[model samples]
Structures are given as structure tokens and as C-alpha cells.
Target chain A: MELFTLIDILWMIFFLSLMIGCGVLFYRLGRRSESDFFLAGRGLPWWLPAASVYATHTATDTPMWVTGVIYRYGMRGIWYTFFSAWCAISAFVSTRIFRRSLAYTQAEWQSLRFGGLGSELLRGWMAGWQIFMNMFILGWVGMAMGKLCNYAFGWPLWIGLMGFSCACAVYVLAAGYWGVVVADFQQGIIALAVIIITSVWGIIAAGGPGAIVSKLALMGESWRVNPFAFTGIFGGEFPFAWFITMMVISIIGGFGMGTSIDWYVEAQRIQSAKTVRDASYSIWAGTALVLVRNSLWAVAILGFYVMFPNIPSQAEYELGWFRIGFEYLPVGMVGFFFAAVLAIHLSTISTHLNLGAMYATRDIYHHYINPRASERRLVWVGRISTAILLLGSFVYGLMMEEITKWLIFALWIMAAGVWLPNILQVMWWRFNAWGYLSSWIANLGLSWLVVWVLPAFGLIPDLPDYLQFWALMVLGALIYVPVTFLTPPEKMDRLVKYYVMSRPLGWWGPVRKEAEWRGLLHMKGED
Target chain B: MAWIRRHWTPEEADEWQKEDWIAIILSTFSYIALTIGVALSLLMLAVGFIVLILGIGLSVLLFFVIDPKLKAVSSGYEKKQKEYLEGLERVQRWEE
Candidate 1:
């Protein structure tokens, strides 16, 4: 383990105190009402939440994963990170519509979109799933921090996992998202600055950009520098087909809500914006920053490859970016780097804590358990829920080691089967809550059969991940589509209200006419 | 009537028009070019600089095309937001 000077320890203490102080600073604002607790009263300008978006995504494991891919596949590996490009279209389309709907969470929006028993069931299920998903994410990311700390300071895994998360929960419990967003703005800047400095420093260490380029060429790995250097159309490790499938998923998926897992987090930022325009710009710009940050890490990983070209293990190379910061940065700056890691960890932890609490408090408690709960009572429920989530995350974090595979299966299976239904709910008026709900159920079972069950029984060869995505989508549609046609459309009154307020796109001709007949819609030339 | 719609009334902006599609296309291209361009540019490649510039250009055009429509939507929607929020609250309470 590297020895740290007194200055290094001081730097860390100072950063920690500053982050915790946000809770004390914003405590009044956070307790004013339920909206304030979860969304800062939904009155924030675009830039504040945009900064939060950037900070929340820059988790401790992000660099490790980015480095892992870049080390393995060179510049082409950046495409893997491009799954976030769903925000590209979402900023203009779903962002605007959802912002108009003014729903605090996607679960809340379901009841607004579809009426009656089906909508109620969908809402309850979504809220429960979100609560579970947030806890799972917190555990997954918290363990990543634990592992990093173990590598750096020789600390035990649980100490690293539980310690920083508990520190973050202080502010989350004190001020909810008020503290989270404010701290995120400060943390986002520090993390971005350090990321830039370390990347450039590493690039310089690898004999500067010019030298690095010449060295790669001499090493006969020039294809590593080319982003478009795919092995072949359908065969190689990095095939053109896989790239095309990813592009289609990333870009087209933006048209629907919840198409990407990040949408749930971005949904909070979307509602927190002051206006439709602000919401649009925030998602677009924040994700643009994310893509740019990935590029910065890609080059730094390239530099790591240059200096240590012969390393064969994926685990070692995955730590390339962190190793650059720890092994290369000057003595005092090592503390600064560690502090930025804290910033990255705390931002994500705080977000999930408050987000999970929001679902539990607003969707479950206030809506179902006690609709008559006062604003003050609701805010308290939010804090209590936040505490519960924090404690649950610790339990999940400890068990994460053994259950990692099953959770991975859960997240991946969720993506493919529900991908189209997610979009269809936004675009098609006839797609009811039953259809959307069925897609989720179908995806869970089908993903198992395709990915593991059939292959294990020798009924079929193991298909590649891209092919699994195709198979799941085709198989899932067969189930949900028939169910949708058999079921009646959403109530006309409910659809019209949603249509007038949110103005969704696609296949809404009859609803549009009905809305017009009811004198709900204003024509294009109307004042 | 111009090549791109730079002006929008709230009602017109409420519709999904060519301007929305144009913004989507430009936004998609900007992300691709920016990702590839920034990485290659860091390695000091000449093509990287060109692509990076193209990405920046597309981003600017996208803002211009979409801003007016978004602003119009926001302005119009803000007027009705209070009423909508009230309705939403009733729904949350099962009173609607």
C-alpha cells in the first residue's frame, strides 16, 4: 500500500466535510414539502440538474469498465459506452412529453397514461421494482468502491463498502435530493477536472500523444487507433453486426421512456427542470458530457496500453485508469485523486438513496398507504425510506459477491424484451398497461430459456449476446402483441387527458379526433 | 416556409414536425462524431480534428433548429401546468 502524507489526509477530510455540509445547508428547503425533498421543489434551472446528471453517472466503477473495454478492443470499444445515446432523441421527444406530464416518477406517469385496475397494478409493480433496482444498484456500485479501497489502502471489503455509503447517507437523510444535487454540482466539477488532469498527465507519461502514436505503429497495432476497424461483417470478436445492433438500440431506443436503465435516473432530472426547454437541454447536454468523458478515458487507457503492452489479464488492465492516477500522480495529488474517487462514489450513492426513497415514499407510502398524509408527514416518510434503503444497500452489498451472476442476468434480460414495449407505450395509444406489463413478465422467462436453459439441455448451441437480443425481442413480441390486441385500449377519457397534456407521438388519429371533438386540443393556428 | 423552421407558435410546436426529426438526426450524428472525434483527436490524428469540428458544427445547428420550438412548448405548457398538477394530485389520491 502507498503511504500518504499528512497533507493527503487533510485533503480527504476537507472534501468529506464539505460534502456533508450540504445537508446542513439545505435542510430547510429539503423539508419544506414532499416535492422539495425529492426534487428540490421542481424549480431548478437547467444547469444544476445537468451537473447532477453528469456527476451521478461518473461512478467509481465507470472508469474501470471503460478501461476494460478500451484495453480489450482499442478505440472501437467506445461504442460499448455509447448505449447512453438514448438521451439523444429522448431530450427532444420523451423529455418534452414527460416534462409536460409533470409526473414525479415514471410509475406515477403510468396511472396518468392508463386508467383503472391494469394501470394500478402496473404502477404498484413498477414502484416496487424501482425500489428494488435502486437498492441493487447501490449495492453493486458500493462494492466496486469497496474493492477499490481494498486495492489502495489495504482496507477490508466491508469497511470500504459500508463506510463511504454511510457517510453519503448523512446528507441524503438530512436534505434528500436538495443535498444530493447541490453536492453533485461541486463533485461533478472536481471529478471532471481531476479526470482531465490525470488523463493528460498519463498521456504525457506515455511519451506524449505523438510518441504514443509512433510507438503503437511500431508495435504493429495501428488498427487499435482506428474506431472503424472491425474484424469482419459477422464473424470477428468485434463484428460489424454487433456494432450495428448496438447503434440501433442506443439511438432508436431514445424515442421511448425507460428504454435504457439510465432513464429512471434521468427521469428525476427531467422533472426537476423548470420548463420543457430546460429539461430537453439538460438531458441532451449532460449525456453529451458523458460521451466526451468516455473519450477522455479511452485515450488514457490507450496510453496505459502503450506503457504496459504485454499485460494479459483483463482484471489488471481494467484498473489501468485508476493505476495511472495512483501510480503516476505526484505525492500530494494522490490524496486529491482519492478525494475525487470519494466524490464519484458519494454522488452515485446519494442519488440512489434518495431515488429509492422517492419511490417508496411517494408511489408506495403516500399513494397507497396513506393518501391523506400531510406534506410534512410525507417528507418524513421520505427520510425514513431513505434510511431503510441505505441499510438495505449494505446488506445487498455484502451478498453481492455470490449473487452477482443472477443480478446480471436480471438486468440484461430486462433490457431486450421490454425495449420495444417501453417505446410502444410512449408512441402507440392502443398499447395498454397490460401489454407493457406482459412484456416484462415474458422477458424474464424467455431470457432464461434462450440464454441458459435450452443451451444447457443441448437443444441448441449457445447463441451470441447480439443474437440473444434478437431472439428475445422476437419471442417477446409474439406474446405481448397478441395480449395487447385482445385487451381493450386505455380509457378514451384518460387517453384524451394524457394526449392533451403530454401530446405523445404515433398512431393517435382516433384519440386526436376525439380530443378535438371534446374541444381539448387547440389547432395549430389558434392563439 | 424557410429551409428550417426558426419560429414556432405554441400550437405549431406542440405537433411533431420536420424540425423535431432534423434535431434528432443532427443530435445522433453529433454524439457519434463527438465520441470518435475526441478520442482520435487526443491521439493527434488529423482526421480526428476534422470530425471533432464537424461534431461541434452539428451541435450548433441542432440547438438552433430545436430551441424555438421547445421554448414555445414550454411557454404554452406553463400556463396549463397548474391545472394539470391539481388533476394529477387528485388521481394520486384516487379522487378523480
Candidate 2:
């Protein structure tokens, strides 16, 4: 019989208690109004929101995914890190503009920018799509967490998933924004600590970096050099073009299009800041953290190659960092490491729950179901919606087998249907409400049709995934632009108001007269 | 516009607080130190892998592990700030 030591048991108890205690503390802090519950009363400091954004955006799958790429292609995996860093840089550059635009969601921006039936239709479509995509991504995150937990502790899949979901739901539902902010700050620290420890442990276990690399060199040149030398006719080791494209998409268009609104947690952070400059600084801080954190992961994955040269077929896509931690790290350190993973899962799930509820309650329920609903009723509806979304994600996690595949599919859908039209509207002045609606419908329809027809008839040519993504992006934009120009434009007055107030950078000219007429313009020291 | 008048204020004092200089200095130093420590460890690990492959000694890995202790201080500072923030929020809520 294997006997567990008192130290091991104590370590487990300490972290477990810490996790539960933190959840309860935030829950109490968040029990005020719905705003406090959903957005932490919009009073979080720049650093807290910044840390939360960084931690939540980079999930558990990140390290493993990067390791898998390195395992297959070698130095090329750095491209993914590069592109993701670029996305953070872009966010920093655009934070000021986004902060000035005070709409709660991108859908709200559509209504504010383009009024009438055209705006309503666009808002309704976007709300529905956002809810679907948000739920789908949450499910993927849950599945990855479940797999990690199952491997680490030998727990059942459902048990691990339910544990994460319930914890997330409890904190999010209780305090809304406040709980999420507090928990995110703690979780972010834990995540950094765990990743750093795991990397060090892995390096030590291999006897040293020198020994690990020597072993790899002895094994084969392929292991040491070009990891992606396997690309050929029948799907070689790594499709470089596809990999590069995905990385580019993740960095550039990923956050460029207002699809970032899918991240309600970030929006809450923006809302929390005391001023536009404060909000922008928070984004900058968050982006800086992500850049540093992702780079660490990239290095860690490369280290994995030196440590474990020949990954088995089944464990190819498994998180090498988690596997190494469980196998090599000390018993006490193991508990803290697992707690970090739990932090990643819980933060993402709770953020999604809050965001999904916001979309359903603010965009759909209040707009459609009960336009005159009281704040109390709206908050109740939000809680109910959050509970339901959590349950659905939990179930989806159970049903899904391959988490990476699920995430890729979700990203494709978001890139095509959600991102394409949203980017057009933000960057192009001629993109009208009718054009947004048409682009959205056309993108969804065409993507669905392509998925069905290509696979069914075996006509899906051997092409990289990014090729398909690029095709969709280009085609969606082409259709959206022409259709928008052909259709009657939205009311000029409303456009002028939104453009001036939001100060969005686009083709629109400054509406000085409109600003004065609306009594929005102010002279220095007038007050 | 009505909502704007109610929420927006021209008073600079009410709109903004003095930058939290202590918090900024502490956080920035902690971040820089932690980042450098991580980078050095990564570099050491890489060097160790090369040495082992070339039949060199395993002494470098020890250096990698020892340096991480320096990071503990930074982590302590972060924990302190987190606690301070939580306490401030609680006190504010109670007063309200």
C-alpha cells in the first residue's frame, strides 16, 4: 500500500482551503446590487483588471498547445507567440479609442452608431451569435481543465468539470464584477508562480538544460532542429503556412474586430477605471503582462522538447508542463501547481458566465423580452441565465473528447461570422446597419454551407485551415462592403453623434457642428 | 445628456486622485525583478541542456533553482498589495 505523508495531506488542505476561502470572501464582497455583482461596481484599480485580463485570456491550453507545436515543428512555434504578442500590442495602441466608446457591448455600439430598425436587426443577430460563440468557447476551456484534472488526480471527468463550474458560478453569481476582479488578481499571481516553478522543475529534473539538449541531439537531428520537417502530401508533421496564418489571425484580426466585446470581463475593467486614461493604462498593463507570460510559455515548451524528446502518439497533444509537474515536482509543490490550473479554469468559466448573462440580459432580454423590466427583475434574469449557461458548458465539456479541436472550430466560427463584419463596421464609415446584418447572415450561411457541402461530397480539397479562414474573411468583407453601399445609409445625425462622441478612428470626418448642437463641446476652463 | 450631467463632473479633484506613487514603485520593481529572474532561469536551463549534451557538468541547474528564491520577495509584495486593496474595498463598503 502506498502511504501518504502528513505533509502531503497538509499541503493539499492548505491550497484547497485557500481556494474555497477566497471564493467565499469575494462572494460576500459582491452581494450588493447587480452592477456590483456583474462588474465589481466598476471600481477596480487598473492593475487588478489588467492582471485579470492577462490571466483569463491565456488559458491552460496555451502551454500545452505551444508545446505540441514545438514538439512537432521546433522553433516555428515562436510564430504563434509572436502573433499573440502582436495582438497585445494592437490592443495597447487602440485602448484609448475603445475607452472613449462607452457602449457596454459591440451590439450596443451598433445601436448607438446606427439607429432605427437596421440597428436593431444587427444588434439582435450579434447578440445571438455572441452568446453561442461565448458558450462554445467556455465549454472548450472546461473540457481542457477537466482533462488536466483527470490526468493529475485520477478524478472523474464530470467531477472535475462540475467542481470548476460550480466554483466559478458561485463567485460570479454572488458578486458579479467584484468577485471576478478579486479572484482574477489572486489567480493571475498563482498562474505566474506555477508556470515559473514548473519550468524550473522540468529543467532540474532533466539534470540541467545541457543534459536535456545533449539527449535531444543524440536522439536525432530532427529533434534538435526543424520540428516541423514533417509537412508533405499526406499531412506532414506541421503545416507551416496554416500554423503561421492561425498565429497571424490570433494576433491581428483576433482583437482588431470588436469581437473583443466577447470578453465582458475586459469591458468591465474598462468601465471600472476612473477615467479614459486610467482605462487605457489598464489595457496597456494587461497587454504587457500577456506579452511576458506568453513568452515564458514559449520558452517552457521549447524546454519540454529538450526534456521529453520522443512524445508518444497518444500524449502528443497532452500538456507536457502538467505531465512533467505531476511526474517530477515535489508533493507539496504539486498541490500549488494544481491550484494554478484550477485558477485558470475558474477565472475563464466565471468570466464567460458573467459575459454570457450580460449579452442575454442586456442585449436580448431587456431589449426583446421585457423592455420595461425593472433593475431587480433584470438582475434576476441575469442570474438565471448565468446558471443555465454554466450548466450547458458543464454538459458540453462532458460530451467533447478533443478539447483542442473544439477550440479551433470555435475560433473559426468567431473569425468568420463575428469578426469579419465587426471589423468592417469599426474601420469603414460606409458600413451601414443593413450591411452589418447582411454580412453577418451571409457569413454564417456561407460558412455553414461550405462545412456541409465540402465534407459531404469529399470535394474539400487538401488545403490549409488558414486558407479557408482567409477565404471566409475576404469573402465576408467583399459581400458586406458592396451590400452596405448599395443599401440606404443610416440616419446622418445619429452617425455624427456616435462618431464624434466615441472618437472612433475611421473614414468619418469630424462633425464640429453636430458636437456644438448637442452641447457636447466644451471650452477650456468653462466650468 | 441628462445622465451625463448627473455622473460627469468638472471638478478635477473629484475626477482623479493623485497617482499612487508607492504602489506604482513597488509594483514596477516587483515586476522587473520577477521578469529578470524568469528570463535568467530560462537562460540557465537552456545553457544546462547544451552542457549536458556536450558531456559537461550539471552544475548550472542548481543556479537556476536557487535564483527563484529571489522571486519570493516579489510574490510577497504582490500578496501585500492584494490584501491592501481588499481591505480598502471592504472599509469603503462599510462606510457607505
Candidate 3:
């Protein structure tokens, strides 16, 4: 069969038209100012950001990643991917705090929280790091999109990367965050539709869910049906013990210890909401969308399991999502499936492009080079920055040989790298720039030692991924705490102001008392 | 010139001008409730495609009734933002 028949081609064209139309409709919404470009002028209603947050996260690789895990680990495997869900617990609390802080970017929050050369250094370092990280993530997702196209339709990887890159860049450049938000809402719905239909189709094709369960029963792996089949932490993805610890840290840090904390979430959607209440709702909305998205994939996996019950190796299991789509889906339905896949890719890449441009243009370029630059000039610079990010990701995507390895890199290394600093920056008032900088630097070195160097030399006997992750987090702490005490604390004036604005509940006891004494706050728990 | 610049103006207050407390409580709860309802219904359906009838029935019920009630609860605050000021005043007794 031809990869896409005429009807499928028509569906693809229709899908592309909607995406472009979404961009054009919102073209005027972000033209006037930097706020418009970065945060949709901070006038967005709750639902828009809510949809965008959920939409950007459900990228092309999300279903593939979900399927790969299920095929290997059964139902319990979802906990590995559902780590992002932990953010919702934190989101419920931070929305009030993030909206109140009013810092445009998370990097901008440093100067709001700290002062003197320490604040300056922290701010600059974080801005640069965020820009790099955003591009790196864009490249990561870009490569995944390329792999999907190559695997499903026999397209060359580089062409797939470049083609999608240009399409996303054009829409992103057309309207800034406005375009990104509108496109996300539309694309999120379309992608959700595709999943709903395909998942149901897959179920029907497999003789329904009963047949799937019966087949698994015959294989003597009935345990696969249960979601809580938590076999053991020692063997699976993240040793059970370490996974619990990580969850504790994630939840504690996300919600902030005791008081509400923002954790400098890179989600621009949160900051774009019209009110703190709106921001809070957006997180819940996003989390709900994600959970449903996963459940839909679960239904499809039931069909997938029925089709291929025994796999020779992990490679085939990971390719389960692709094989099911290519082999089982009906002719025109297959085209819509690919369109959905492309929709997923485009939505994610567009958000990253807009966010990266916001950081590069607002936080770095205009902040340092031309503090007084016109809104028009900054908008133009934003467009240019989006183009640079697009090309940069395309080049990086071409070079990446596999998506699974990068998955490990993102989950284990990057999570550990930011884990301590993100929590400490909010919880510990004494954690100065030196400490923050040291923690990240230490995390990088220690993570490298555990993840790469030790294993390569055969000195550590090739540790599991979870053990490597635990070592990085523990060692990161051992390095950063002493560094914090060694360095002087952030200046007092900065602390007092930030305390009054955020009313952050933490070790800021002294500062909180001071604010109370001065009547800057009427009473405790006012937030 | 240094590579760092502070865009966060200290002179400008970061105090978020809050929406009416009635609006916030109304909006947040409605979404949470509706979401949970939908999730449970879907879970029922996913247990077996045979139960998809139950799933479809529940989803339709949620869409027709639960979803609209949430809208009414939420938009009631927005539409009646002024009339609800007394409720907002009581909420402000506790909140910022």
C-alpha cells in the first residue's frame, strides 16, 4: 500500500490548514509588547493556558514512551512516565505564588528573591542555562519526531526534522505566545480526537478488551492487568526505594516544604494566566488532560498486547506503538494517525521555540544589550530568536542517533541536576548564588561519574539507571549544603521584599517575623 | 556593561490583584470536580470494552449535566462578579 492514499493526503492538507489558520487568527494578539509575545500579554483566561500546558506536554514521543514502558513493565510501568503528574500537586499551590511574583521568566525570579552580585550572577547563569536547556529539549523532541516519520513512512530522518522545523518556525514567528497558545488549544483537541478514535479502533480490532485480558490470562501473566503491579523497585526502571524518595522530593519541592513554592517551573503557560486562580486551575486542567491521554493509550496497549503477546527483546516492545499504527490502523485512519503525530510534534516544537525566544530575546538580549529597546524591536528580535532556535534544533536533531538514550539523559541527569537547586532556592533562604551554582556544577560532575565514567572504567560494575540517579541526588546535596554555609547569605533587603510579596512559608522565619513587625503583612497565612 | 540586568522592578509591587474570592473558589472547585467525574467514568469504560456502554453513558451524562453545572458554578462568579462582592468580602477576611 502507498504510505498515504489520496484521502489521507487530503486529511493531512486539511490538518495543516487548520494549524496555519490558528496562527493567522492570533497574529494580532501578540504584536504590541514583550508581555504579549512571552505571556500572551498576561491577559489569558484560565482555559487557554490550561489547554496549552497539557497540549505542549503531550508531544509526539509521549505515546511511544508510554507504549514502550507498558510493553516492558506492564501497567505499573506507567508510574515511570507519570512522574510529570507529580507537578500537579505542586501546581495547585504555586499558581497563587507564581502569579504574585510577576517575574516574566523563572530566571527573572532570582533578582526578585536575592540581591547584590550574587543575585546578578545567579540570574545571568540561570538565563543562559535556561536558554540552552530549552533548545536542547526542542532538539530532543525534534529528533523524536524525525524518528517517528522515518519509522512509519520511510522518510529520511534529516528531511523529516527539517520539514517539521520550518512549519513550526513559521507559525511561531507569525504571532509569538499568542500563536503558540491558540495553536496548542486547537492542536491539542485534534490530537486528542485522533487518540480517541485510534485507541477505540485498536480495541475493536483486537476483539475488544475482554479478548485482550483473556489472551494475557492464557500467557500466565495475569498480573499485567493490574495497574499497581509494583513487582519490585530493585529490578524495574527506578529501583523502588529510590523512586519513592524521588517522589517525596518531587512532591515536597513542587508544593514547597510547608509553605507554597513555585519551583521555577519552566511552564510559561502558568505565568500567562490572567489571575493566580486561573493559573491554579490550568495545572489541574493540564493534569486531567494528561491522565485521560494516558488512559487512552492504555486501551490501545490492550489491543497491542493481544496482537503481539511475546516479544523477543525490548527493541520490538519499544516499537509497538509504531507497528500497531502502521499495520493495524485502516487506510484513511492511518493518515489521520500520522497527522495526529505531526500535530503532536508541531505543538511541542512551537511552544519550545516561543519559550526559547522569550528567554533569549527578553532575558538576555534586551535585558543586557538594549535595556531600552522598543517593543517592536524586541518582537523582531523574538522572531529572529525563534528562527535561530529552530535551525539549532534541526541541526541537533539530525545528529542524535536514538531517542531512548536522550530519554534517560532527560529523566536521570537533568532531573537530578535541577532537583536540589529548584527545591533549595525556595525552601532555604540561606542557599546563596554560590550554593545554587555549586549544586548544579556538582550534579553535572557527579552525574557524569555515576552515569558514564564509573561504568565505562568497570570500576562501579555497571550500575542500574536508578542507582546512578540516587548517587547523583545524594552527592549533589553533600556538595551544595557546605557551599551554602561557606558563602554569605543573600542581602536582607531583598529577602524582606520577596517575603512580603510571596509570603513564602519556609526557613524565612526571621524575615517573616520582620514583615509582620513592620505591618507589611497584616497577619500570618494571609496568602 | 555587565551581562546581567534586573528586569524585576522592586518599586513595582508584585502583589497580584486577586480575582473575587467567590470567583476563585467557584472556578477551582468546579474544574476539579468535573475532571474527577470524567476520569472515573473513563476508568469504568477502560476496564472492559463491554463496559464501554457504561462509559459512553457516563460520559454523555457528564457532558450534558456535570459539565454544564460546572460552567454555571464557575461563570456564576464571573457574570455576577459585582453581586457576589459580599461573598468576596467574607473570603477576604481570611485571604490576601
Q: What is the TM-score of chain A alone in each candidate?
A: 0.98, 0.86, 0.92
TM-score of each: 0.98, 0.77, 0.82
Query: What's the lDDT for all of these models?
Result: 0.92, 0.59, 0.66
Looking at candidate 3, what is the lDDT of residue A275? 58
* Regions more than 4 Å wrong, model 1: A523-527
Evaluated with lDDT, which candidate comes out highest? Answer: 1
**Residue pairs in clash, model 3:** A233-A240
Residue by residue across A1-527, what tens digits does model 3's lDDT show? 27789888888888888897788677787788887888887778888887787778888778878888777766656555555444444454455555556667776666677666776677677777667666777777887777777776778777777788688777789899998889888888888888788777777777776777677788888767665566485765535675566445544455441111113333577778865557656766676577667766765775687788777776567667666676778877777887788788888888888888887886788766777677899899999988888878876676666654765564466576557677677767787878877877787788878888888998887876556666777888888889889888877777777776554534777776777788775554454
Q: Which stretches of candidate 2 lie over 4 Å from their true place?
A: A1-6, A26-29, A81-83, A86-93, A212-255, A259-265, A314-317, A402-407, A417-420, A448-460, A510-527, B1-41, B44-96
Computed on C-alphas against the true complex, the DockQ of each candidate is 0.84, 0.06, 0.04
Which candidate leads in TM-score?
1
Among these predicted structures, which one has the highest DockQ? Answer: 1
Full ranking by TM-score: 1, 3, 2
lDDT of 2 at B76: 29
